[model samples]
Target: MKSALGKKKPLELEDNVCRRTNVFKLRGNVPNYLEESGSTAAFQPDGWGYKSHWGMAVNVYSTSITQETMSRHDIIAWVNDILALNYTKVEQLCSGAAYCQFMDMLFPGCISLKKVKFQAKLEHEYIHNFKLLQASFKRMNVDKVIPVEKLVKGRFQDNLDFIQWFKKFFDANYDGKEYDPVEARQGQDALPPPDPGEQIFNLPKKSHHANSPTAGAAKSSPASKPGSTPSRPSSAKKAAPSSSASKSDKDLETQVIQLSEQVHSLKLALEGVEKERDFYFGKLREIELLCQEHGGENNDLVNRLMEVLYASEEHVSSSLIKSMNSPSSRRSTDSPSVSDNFRFV
Candidate 1:
C-alpha cells in the first residue's frame, strides 16, 4: 500500500484501496466502466487549475493512441509499466480527479472522464511529466515545495510573460512566403468595376431617374421640335399643375391611412374601456344585492324592537290605572270624590 514516496500516509491507503476496487470493477466490464468514468479528464473550457491541463494532456494522448490503433489493454499495460505502478494506480491516474491532482499538485473539482473512454492513453505523457515533478519534490522535500497559491500566482504570470515573449519572437523571426504588396494592390485595383445595375440601385431614386438617358431624351424631344419655343412656357405651366395635383393626392392618401390606423386603435381602446366598465358594473350589482339582503334583515330587527316597546308601554298604563282605582286610593281621594257625587246628584 506504500506509495513511491518513502513515508507512509493515510492518502496512500485510501488511494490503494480505491484503485484496487476500481481495477476489479474494470475487469468485469472494461468498455462500460471506462465509458462511465473516462470523461473525467475531458476538456472543459471554463475549468481552472490542474483539471484543465490534465484534460489537454488527455486530448493530446488520445490523438496518439488513436493514431497508433492501440487497444484498451495495451494502453493500460503501457500506463502501468511507464509509471512503475500496478493496474490500480494506472486506472486511478487515468481518472479525472486523480489525474488532475497528481499533475497539478493539488486536488481539484471532481470531473468525469467517462466520455474519454480511453483515458489510459494519457498515461504516457502524464507519467513522464509527473515523474519529473516528483523528482523535484524529492529534492526540495514536500513541505518546502511551493504552496498552491504561490505556485499558481508565480506560474501563471511566468506563463503569461513567456507567451508574450514567444509571440514577439515568432513575429520577429517568422519568414513564411512573402506576398508582394505591389502585386496585391494591383490585383485589388484590377478587379472589375461593380455591376451597373448595382451602381444604379445604390444611387438615390431621384438622382437615378435624372441620370437616365430616356429622361434626358424625353426632355430634349420637345426642345428639338422646330418653332416649339413659343409654346414651351404654357406646356410647363400645365405640367406644373398636374405634378402638384399628384403630390396633393399622395398627401391625402397618407393622411387617410394615418386616420384609419388611429380610428382602429381608438376602437380597440374603447372596447377595452367598455369591458373594464362592465366588470365594475357587475361588481356594483353584486354589492347592491348584498345591501338589499342586509336591509331586509335590518327591517325585521327594527320591527321586533318596536313591538317590544309598544307592549311595555301598554303594560305600564294598565298597572297605573289599577293602582288608582284600588280601595286605599279611594279613601285618600274622599273629599274630591264626595264633591263629585254631590254635583252628580
Candidate 2:
C-alpha cells in the first residue's frame, strides 16, 4: 500500500496510474481498459504489452498498458486509419505518451510487461490506477515532470469560469436585463441622492402674525384708523319751566327708590346663597373627616348610617306618636320649619 500523504509529488503522476481486475473481462459492454477522458479502451486478440525504447523486463498490471486487449495488427491498423502513421504515431497520440517519455528517462531500465485491465466498477478501478501511478512515479523518481498545485489550480479556475458564465446567463434571462460580458451581473440602478433641503420639513416654523409688532397694537384699539382725529363732547345747555322740572325731579326720585329696593333685595339674596353654600361646604368637610376617621373606606359610612338609623328608631317612633297626639302635622304660617330659613340647600 502507498500513502496518500508524505509521498514526494504523488499527485503529479495521475496519468501514469493503471488497474487490472477479473471483473472487467472483455465480454458485452465490459471494459478491459480506460482512456484519459474516462472512455473504455477497445480490446484486441493479441495480448497487451509495454516496452521502452531501451528495453527492460518490468512486470506491470494489465491496466498500465494502453492497448489492453488489442492485437499488434489491430493497433497498427487503428493508427494507420486514424493518424495515417505507423506504431510511432499511435504512441505519440497516446494520452500518457508525453509523461511516459519523461518516465522512460527517469526509469531507463524499467518498462511495463503486462497490461492493466479496467473493470466495470471503473470509479474504484481509477482509485487503483492512482495507486499504481504513484508507485510507478516513485519508482521512476520523476519529480520535475509536473507540479500538482499548478494542475489543481488550473482545473479549479476552469470550473469557476463555467459556473460564473452559467450564473450570468441565468440572471440575465430571469430578471429581463441585457447581459454584460464584463460585469457578468444584472440588477437595478443605485438609489439617487436626496434633496438638500429635505430635512427642513421636520421642523415647525413660527407664524408671521404672532411674531409681528403691528398685530399686537391693532388688537389694543377699538376700530380706529391709524393717525386719525379723536371725537369731542357737546357743550350747549337748555332750561325748562319750574313745574316741569319739579315733575322730572319726582320721576327721578321714584326711579331711584325702585333701583334701591332692587339692590337691597339682590344683596339679601346673595347673602342667603353665601350662607347656604358655607353650610353645605362645612357638611361636606365633616363627611370627609368622618370618612377619614373610619380608615377611608366608603362601606364604613354605610355601616355608620345603619347604626344611626337603628338608634333613632325609638326617637322617630316617639316623635311620630307626639305628632299624632298634636292638633296638626302641618306648619303654621307664623312658625316656619328650620328648612324654611334657607330652603335651597
Candidate 3:
C-alpha cells in the first residue's frame, strides 16, 4: 500500500533554473543527459540540468515497457532488488525525505516498474556524481523555475503590433455580418423604393398555342374561312392486357422470392434467440436448485455467480444448464439436506 514516492528521499535543492532542469531530467528524461565519453554529462537541450565539467552529477535513466506489466506492488519489490544490485548509492537518493517529497508531488502513488526502474538508473548516476547533480540543479538566476515559454520560444516583440496586423486582416475580409448600422450606412449609397410585384409583371405568359394543337391554332390563327374546316376521326383507346398481366406476374414472383428469403432469415434469428433463452432458463433452474440445497436465496446465488463468472445475467443464466450438470455445483446443492438432517437428529 505504500507509495513509491513515499520511498524516495526528500531533498529541497537550491530553487533555480538549473535545479529545475535537474528535476526535469530526473522526472522526465535522464538517459538523454548521459555523457558518451564518461566525461561531463551533456543534456542536449540546455534547460535539462546538464552542465559541462559537472562530472557524475547527471543521471541516465531508462526503462523497458511490457504488454502486460506488473502492478505497483510488484514494481516496488523489483525496485528494491535493483537498489541492492547497484551498490546502494542510487537507493540512497530514493530514500531521502527530499526525493520522497518530490516523487509524492510528481507521480501518482503506484508508478509502473518501467518509470521507477528507469529513474533508479538515474539515481545510480546521481549517487556516483552527487556533487555534479547538485550543481546541475544549482540556481544561476534569482528565479526558481525557469520561464520555459520565454526560454524555449524566443521572446515575442510587442504583441500590440501583432494585434494591429490581425485587425487589418479582419477589416479586409470582414463580411458585413457584424457591421455597425450607423457606420455601415455612412459607407452605403441611398436605396430606392422597390417596384412592387416586378417578377409577376415581368413573367412571360404561358402560351396556349405552344401546348395545344387545334384549339390553340383556332384561337391564334386568322379566323379560318368560315366553312373551310372538316371533321376528323378520334383515335381508339390503347390496351395491352396480356403484356401487363405477364409483367405483373413476374413482379409478384420476385416479391414472393424476396419475402421467402426474409422469412428464412427471420426464422434463423428467432431460433438463435430461442436457444439463448432456453440456456438462460436452464441456468436459472440450476441456480434455484443450488439455493434450495444451500439454504440460500436463488436471487443471491444468481448475483454471486454472475460476479464470480464476470458475465452478464443473461450470459450467466445461459450457462446454467452446464452448471446444473456440474458435479461440484450438484454436490453443494445436495450437502444442505444432509446438514439439515444432522441438525434434526
Best by lDDT: 2
Q: Which TM-score value belongs to model 3?
A: 0.20
TM-score of 1: 0.21
Instruction: Write the number of the candidate with greater lDDT, choosing between 1 and 3.
Output: 1
276: Cα error in model 3, Å: 2.0
Q: What lDDT does model 1 reach?
A: 0.34
Query: How well is each residue in 184-256 modelled by candidate 1, as lDDT tens digits?
Result: 2222221111221232222233443364444554576554467556567777766765676567667756866
Worst 10 residues of 1 by lDDT: 18-27
Off by over 4 Å in 1: 1-230, 299-345
lDDT score at residue 208, model 3, on the 0-100 scale = 35
Which is the better candidate, 1 or 2, if ranked by lDDT? Answer: 2
Q: Model 2, poorest ten-residue lDDT window? A: 113-122
Tell how far residue 10 is off in model 1, in angstroms: 99
Tell me the TM-score of each prediction against the true structure.
0.21, 0.20, 0.20
Which candidate has the top score in TM-score?
1
Compare candidates 1 and 3 on TM-score and give the better one: 1
